[model samples]
Target: EAYAKALRGRTSDHPVALPHPDVTSQDPLSKGLGLMERMAEGFALAMDDDFNSREAIAKVLGGVREATRLLD
Candidate 1:
């Protein structure tokens, strides 16, 4: 809930912010980092499901697969 609320206020690019002051968009590593963060976010969202039943587990597993698709 808190996480979703926080994301609700961000621009699409906000999550891609650099970790270091010296980093720039031109850095190849930045692209990889952005993808990694997005993938991690997907996994987090999957695990954050409020449901407590079996359906929730299915949602989580689906989310995990969706997030990992970034690796392909």
Candidate 2:
């Protein structure tokens, strides 16, 4: 959510801002980052289903780590 928010809030060409690209020309890394976003959505759903926010939080961290490793 924060990632998407940053993308929305940042001005164009800002360093450390997420790139806003058209569907056709985006880099593969952006596609992978999209998966991280989907995982966050899943984590939210899991939290609602299981009612254990701790697990949801862990899942979010794991997803972030995975995304970081991918970027690195």
- Least well predicted 10-residue stretch by lDDT in candidate 2: 20-29
C-alpha lDDT (0 to 100) for residue 34 of candidate 1: 57
- The residue-by-residue lDDT of candidate 1 on 19-42, one tens digit each, is 422223443344445545554555
Model 2 per-residue lDDT tens digits across residues 1-72: 547676676776674655543223346446565766767777888788868787788888877776676567
lDDT assessment of candidate 2: 0.66
TM-score of 1: 0.35
Residue 64 local lDDT, model 2: 76
lDDT values for all models? 0.50, 0.66
